[model samples]
Every structure is written in structure tokens, then in C-alpha cells.
Target: MTNAHELGLPERVPAGDDLPAEVTVWEVGPRDGLQNESSVVPVEVKLEFIDRLADAGLTTIEATSFVHPKWVPQLADAEPLLAGLTRRAGVRYPVLVPNERGLDRALAAGVEHIAIFASATETFANRNLNRTLDEQFAMFEPVVSRAVAEGLDVRGYVSMCFGDPWEGVVDRAAVVAVGRRLLDLGCSQLSLGDTIGVATAGQVGALLDDFAAAGTPTSALAVHFHDTYGQALTNTLAALRHGVSTVDSSAGGLGGCPFAGSATGNLATEDLVWLLEGLGVRTGVDLDRLADTSVWLAGELGRPSPSRVVAALRG
Candidate 1:
């Protein structure tokens, strides 16, 4: 893994809850951002986009997802994509693994980090995971366990941490339960996802409070916000106030979950960078180059950038 100087923003962690001196951003542009495209982006395009993201100071990038092509036809080129990756010494490239099968493929590709996902609601869980909450946990118990034993950093995504379209008002109890279980099962970090972007700052406060009460340390959590209703930055500020240091954002705001009905734009990486930098929180990402990469992606995808900040910066 090569170090992306532009992405090395964790300088000095703020003491207490005052402010984080720096933040680490997980860039999901390549995997989550491109998955929903109606057109097939060439493997060359995907590789070039990743390199551009790296050049712009994105330290952590979700390179690709290893799922059945029948499910996500967009990522059918997973193997070739991984094989063609430009490995940087300090950059961390994590791949999304939907199941044990996906894990096998990731392992075959010599991947060192993998992300596994499950929703907080039954409806979303069944649709994305093809199983109930309990069943899904059973599936990951050993997968997470084995991944950890094998020295791979496993990330757990608990989607719909805020609300689900199929099941409204996700319960705080359910959120804490899944989060704790995944952490206990050997996930180094559990990313709390607002899949449909319906979360309010108050709701985010509620989740963090409950997670604290449940013995899940704040440091073990990461916020993954969607900008669907324009609450991403607000919600991120709320998370920061609560002492969370890591956030997941897509470059150019490129991804939406297919399982989430009415799911919309993700938090634009540029917007987050702007916010963090404005607050004087150290996020080593280059705001200028990131916007440039997003502009290129929006043109390549033949769509307007979901990020207003990207557009403003470009203009």
C-alpha cells in the first residue's frame, strides 16, 4: 500500500469532544459510487478513476465489490479490476464482500481488507442479504472470525442505521445490537450507515448515546452518511461532536444502495472535505484535485454531480 500524502490527514486527534484535529475519510467512489450506473464503465475507466482518486489524496478507497455478477452486473469485472489495481504502499484498498463466496474471491485476489454488509431492518436485510437478521449474523460469525484470524481487517456495514423505507424508524436497540455483535465478532470497525439519508442530527445523537450505553466505544464506530435530504454535513458535525473520528464518503457523491427504495445520493467526498477543512479539522485530502476527479467522473457517467460543493468548487 503506497501512502497518498493528500490522504494522510490524521495529524493530532482532538482531545475530549472539542474537535478532531484531523479525520480519516474512507472513499467509496469506485465501488459504491459506480454500482448504480445504468451504463457499464470500462475496466480501464474504473482503474483510471481510482488512480485519480489516489492522486488527489484519498488514502482509503473501496476498490471494488466481489459479488455474483447476476446480482451486481456492474462489478462482474471484479477479478480483472483487482488484478489491474495500482497498489500504493500506504493506501488501504478495501473490497466489498457480500458473502463467504465473495470473501473467497477477495482472498484469491490477495486482498488484505474486506467490507461485509447487513441492514438494520428486516425488509432491507432480506432484500440485500437474502436472510433474516439472525441468519445473517450466523453467516458472518465465522466469516468475520476467519478473516480476523487470517490477519485481514474486516469492516462491518450496518445499513439503515437511521431509517429504512420498508421498515420506518429503525430501532435504537436493533442498531446497538448489530453493532456490538459485529464488533465482538472481530470487526475492527463498524460503519453505521444512513442508507436512505433520512437521519436527523438528533437521531444521530440518539444512536451514539445508546451505543455508548451499550458498551460500544465511540472510537469503534464510523459514520456513513447519505446526502439524500441534505443532512449529511449536519449529521457529520453531530458525529464529530460526539468524538467520532472516521467517516465514509463517496467521491463526487456517486453511490446509492440498490436495495434501498428511494435511496439517493451519498455524501460527496468534496463536501465533507470542505466542511472538515473549514472547521480546521485536518483531512489531508486535496479539495482542488478531488473536485477535478469528480468533474471527470460526472462527465464520464453523463450525469450531473450529486455534490453541490463539487460544482461550486469547480466553477
Candidate 2:
């Protein structure tokens, strides 16, 4: 039997860190993780993946994206995947809706929660969303409004919040501006994304300070980090210390941005769980189950998981 202690699960050692009592680990494996894969994952495998994640105690799992298939062909099974999903109590399944058309598809599929991706840099906004920096809000406004009207929760993702490949160092003001617009458009939460993973822990704290100065509470904020520079976990700790309770992570570190060449795998959920539990913060996730799930998914993908924690716990 695989023991929990043998799973490389961190011991609970409260260092008296100023962090949230309960943190929300928003699992983005099924959608964001699989979206960038060169080969399409079977929808059946995706469903089982979500079920396993839920059983591992992830409360919010991003299911799939409703974007055009021509772009993210890996998740073309979005509709069918949602159709076959057996919803569990106390678990929220949020899907990504690219536009009003995508929002329509999500609504038709009975999606209770939807997320919109926006960019903080002009170059990234143009490349990823086919809209200019400011123009992105125009596109999101109607989608967010309609979703809110339909009584659905909306999450806004602001990519390139810390740095951009083309634009170089991103201005904190620009990120706050984009995020404020998204929140003003009725998004219940705004997830700041280090799309290229160029952020440092200092940068994370500074940006959160900027949002706070701009009258945005940390309660309405989340952090999504990529591990390109190996700073994701430290940056996540910075966010948590800043009173941000929701952290977005991918199981087994399974995703990168297809649009952003510099973007790499997201902060791994297994790694995050170990860090949080070690700090004596509550995430309500089973480390042993999460590691086992990551191992299983890695086999399905025919590759080793990039997560250091997953690699260490693979015994």
C-alpha cells in the first residue's frame, strides 16, 4: 500500500506564517493542462481525471474551454466532456469561455461558472486574444454581463501581469487597470497570471500592493503562476502572505500557453499542497491521492510529470 507519509507529503510545521486559514486550490489540469498538449486526450480520461481530483478534495476544478476548436483542438471535446460529467456536491466546475459565442456555448452546456482570459500587455493581448489591450475589455464586458445576468459566477484571468515576452517588464499599473476593468465588468474574482513565469517573489508582493492601493481587496484576487523561471512557489507564497487565499495550480504541472512561446508549465498542485500543508494552512487536499493521480495522468501522457514534488513522491 502507498502510505501517505511515503508520498513526500510535508509534515505540518506551523511557522506562524501570516496566511489564510483555508486556501482554495483552483485546479486547472483538465482544461489548461491538456489544452497545450500536442495530442488530444480522450474525453473519458479527462472525466476520470476530474473525478480523481475531486476525490482528492479539490473544490474548484476548471473543466474545459469553450473556445473555437481551430485554436485549442485538444479541448474540442468540451461540450461532450461537460455532458458526461457527473457533478459532485460542493465541487465547482468552471469552464473557460473565450467570447460571447463561447459564453453562449457554456451557458447552453449548463456551466455554472466560467472564466475569461485577458492580457495586461498589448502584444500579448493582440497575439493571444486577437484584441488590443483596452479592446480586450470590450470583448469581455458583454460576456461577463451576460454571465452575471444568468446568475453564473465569472472569473477573470489577467495574463502577463508580471512580465511579457515582447513588452519586456510589465507595468504594475497596467495590470491593475486591466484587472479593475474585468472586475468592473462583473467578474467575481480576478486571477493575475504570470503567463511567461518571469515573476519573482518581490514582484508578486509589489503587484498585490498595487491592487490594494487601487482599492481592490485581496479577497477578490487569485494568483496563477507558471514555473518557467522556477519562481512559481516563492511567488505563490508571496501572494498567500498578501492575504490572497485562492491559488491556481495545475495537477502534475501539466500546462503551458500555446500562444505565449515563453510561457511554461503552471505551478504544480502537488507542490503547492505540500507547501501549504507544511505552513499549517488548510487546503483540504489529500497529498497522497494527488500524487497518485499525477502519476496516473503522467502515464496516460507518456511523459514524466514536471513537478518536483510529484517526481519525489513517485515511489
Candidate 3:
């Protein structure tokens, strides 16, 4: 394979106004990326994929979900996968815990970090969590509280923050209210998800401004964008301009909302790294290794990666 450097990296430009000095690339491939797969990836392969990600310098890697196997059979081997992991010193392996039962499994597996998925719209709450919008918080309250009490770092994911398939447009106030509630419930950070990828750059800036107006600092928030509408990179840039340092991405553009058919793959990590590297922002990610890792996983999944950076560099 040709070296990524041989193809030349993006030219570094002076850091723009309000852009963070450094960004945290939260890798969600092993969990979110593979959860949508039709075929189950073996536990051993999952382990290797995660190890490769850590080696590639991703400090925070979301390992797997503890959701019921009946719901996400693709990650049914979460326990074994977690057990087989060879953890790095400064790298974190967080898992998704749906509720109390999932929390129990994660605690038993010695997980130090966990993320909970929530919805901003009534329709999405009903469709995804089988609960009304208001009632969904009730379910998460106990989970967050318990996780916080256990001294585990908790991340709250608010999906459909931009747009929902069932619902046409989501209100900014509604998203802010949900995020504030999560923060109040002891979640350390809230990840705003464009679950269906319908948001534009303007929408991204407007939402982040609203969160700030509501007293939620950018440090307590993260952005997770999908590339369905080809706006993921643009939207991510807007978020960065608003001082959001932590960005969630999947390696190789591998994930979408499993509950929402309209949703597509996430903002690819390799793509994000390329952009940040060009902007002179440090993300501590090796773009070449990340692209290669994605390429390897694509082969395992029997498909080409949808990431543009991966394609461009690999070619």
C-alpha cells in the first residue's frame, strides 16, 4: 500500500477564529459502526479492531453496547469482547448502557465510562425508546444518577437534535431543555446527534448558540453528525467554530441510526482528522493509520469504506 504521506497531507492553514487549539476525536466504530451491520462481527475481530484504533492514537474509543442481545444482536458478544480487550494506559474504552440492566453488565465488566441514548422529539422517543418524550427522561434519570454515584463518566446522547424522520423539524428550545435535564441528572457531557443528517451549517451554529444561551458550556457538549446529506463536514466545522472540542465520529464512515432508515453513515474519523489537520488543530490521531484501519475493517465487512479520505489516500 502507498503511504498516506506520499499522497501529501492537507496543507496546514492558520487556525481560524474560535477554533479549538486541540480537538478530541471520540471514535465510535466498534459500537455504533458495527451495530448496524447485518452480520455479526466475531468477538476476536472486534477486539483487534479496537486495539488497532488505540494504536492509531484515538484516546477515547467506544467499545460496545450493553443493550439486550434481542435488540442489538450484532453486538451480542459485548461481554466477551470487553473481556478480551488489552487496554492502553491513557486510552478509554467506553460502552453504551441502555438502562439499569445494561448498567449492571457494564459495572460487572469493570467499565469506567458509559453513554446513554436519548431522543429530543416525541415521535423518535416513542419509535426508538418505546416511551413518550417526557417519560424517556424518567427512564434515564435513575440510570444517570446511579452511574454518577458509582463515579463513572457518563455521556448523554440526544438524537434527532437537528431533524427527525418522523418529525419534520425539531425546536431548539426542546433540545436545550433535554440537554439541560441530562446535565442536571449528572451526565457530564451531552452529544447532539443529527440522527438523520438533515442539518446544515447554519443550523449547527444556531443550536450551539442556543445551548450556550441556556447556560450549557461548549465544553459540556459534543457533536455527532451523519453524512446522509453531505453536510457532516460543514456542520462539524460550524460546531468547531462554536468551541466544541469533542467530536464523535466512526472510523470509515460506518454507522447510522439503526432505528431510522433515513439516517446514513456518521462523520468519518479519517475525514474529520483530515479537516482538523489542515486547519492546524491537534486531534492526536494519525490520519494514515486511521484510514488503513478503516480499509481493513471494510474488507472484513465485505464492502468499501464510504469515507472520502480513506478512498483518496488508499487510491
Model 3 regions lying over 4 Å from their true place: 1-8
> lDDT (0-100) at residue 126 of candidate 1?
89
lDDT of 3 by residue, 1-315 (tens): 765367647878856667999999999999999999999999988999999999899999999999999989999998999889998899999999989999999999999999999999999999888999899889998888899999999999999998988778899999999999989999999999999999999999999999999888889999999999899999999999999999999999998888999999999999999999889899999887888899999999999999999998896
Per-residue CA lDDT of candidate 2, range 49-165, in tens?
999999999999999999999999999999999999999999999999999999999999999999999999999989998989888888988999999999999999999998899
lDDT of 1 by residue, 1-315 (tens): 543334433233343547777889999989998888777799999999999989988889999998889888888999999999989989999999887788889889999999999778888878898999888999998788878888999999999999988778999899999888888888989999999999999999899999999888888899999988889999999999988999999998898986676888789998898778767788889888888889998888888887877767565
Q: Which residues of candidate 2, in runs, are more than 4 Å off?
A: 1-7
Cα lDDT for residue 82, candidate 3: 88
TM-score of each prediction: 0.94, 0.97, 0.97
- TM-score quality measure for candidate 1: 0.94
Candidate 1 lDDT (Cα, 0 to 1):
0.87
Query: Which residue segments of model 1 deviate by more than 4 Å?
Result: 1-17
Question: Against the true structure, candidate 2 has what lDDT?
Answer: 0.93
Note each model's CA RMSD in angstroms: 4.9, 1.7, 1.8
Q: Work out how many backbone clashes candidate 3 has.
A: 0
Task: Kindly give the number of clashing pairs for every candidate.
Answer: 8, 0, 0
